[model samples]
Target: MVDRLEQSKALASQARLSVLGWLADPQAHFAHQVTGPPAEIGVCVTLLAARLEMAQPTVSRHLEVLRRAGFVTVRRIGKWAYFQRNEAALADYKAWINDHL
Candidate 1:
């Protein structure tokens, strides 16, 4: 349907894909946080921005695309936004690709 097509389009960007890959292994990809852990809440947006070597706004836009595609989930802790991969959504995406392509 149109929604699925739109979701597919949302994931078509390289930056979004990189975000997903980084989120896949948060512990390995990101540094340890004093607040707690990367796996507990999720990786912080600032950390993601630093790792990607892009501005926070640019990283945020890429995160938004991945979020719309249902590939990432968001958590708000205090004043920061954390992001992590959505395993179920990713599984669904893979299945859809297998079936449609």
Candidate 2:
């Protein structure tokens, strides 16, 4: 598990926060994917890149930070990597915020 400071650093970026917000309601934010259900398997990186209007590599770099910080979880399907918010980690972060600041 990542420390709170690490997670905090990951969220410092607006793009990363946007990714988390979108994943919070994947079905509404992202288009239905042929790879799998958005809510179940998570949203594809391609969709995220398109939605963010950024290059895939750039979006991927943001996602990698979140992944390392445990703010999001990834599921690999063939060549694609899907992502969703780590709700448990999020709850812990929220609780920490409520307790500390």
Candidate 3:
């Protein structure tokens, strides 16, 4: 389960919000991946790093924050890890926002 405060903190970061926005429309934001489908398996950390023009480790840390916040889900294919939006969680978060603030 995700803590509401942690999730709110995750949403406060521009980098992390950018990640979520991109993942929300992976096909348009990201190039077609060879390892797996962008929507199905999500975009690779390396690809996200390149797109964000940031270091892989930095992107990974951002992803870790989002993952812990329940805004994204990660799947490992061999050595590569792909990240996709957790749509249900996102909807729930949105509803929570509506109800709270």
Off by over 4 Å in 3: none
lDDT of each residue in 1-101, candidate 1, tens digit only = 22687678877877777788888888888757666688878899998888888999999988887887787899998889999999998888788889988
Q: Alpha-carbon error at 25 in model 3, in Å?
A: 1.0
lDDT of 2: 0.91
Tens-digit lDDT track of model 3 for 3-53: 999999999988898999999889898756777679878999999999889
Give candidate 2 misplaced runs (Cα > 4 Å).
Answer: none
> RMSD, model 1, all Cα superposed?
1.7
Q: Pairing residues by index, what is the TM-score of model 3?
A: 0.94
- Lowest lDDT 10-mer window, candidate 2? 28-37
Clash tally for model 3:
0
The alpha-carbon deviation from the true structure for residue 15 of candidate 1, after best TM-score superposition, in angstroms, is 1.6
After the best TM-score superposition of candidate 3, give how far the Cα of residue 11 lies from its true spot, in angstroms. Answer: 1.0
- Report the lDDT of model 1 for residue 56: 98
Which 10 consecutive residues of model 1 have the lowest summed lDDT? 1-10
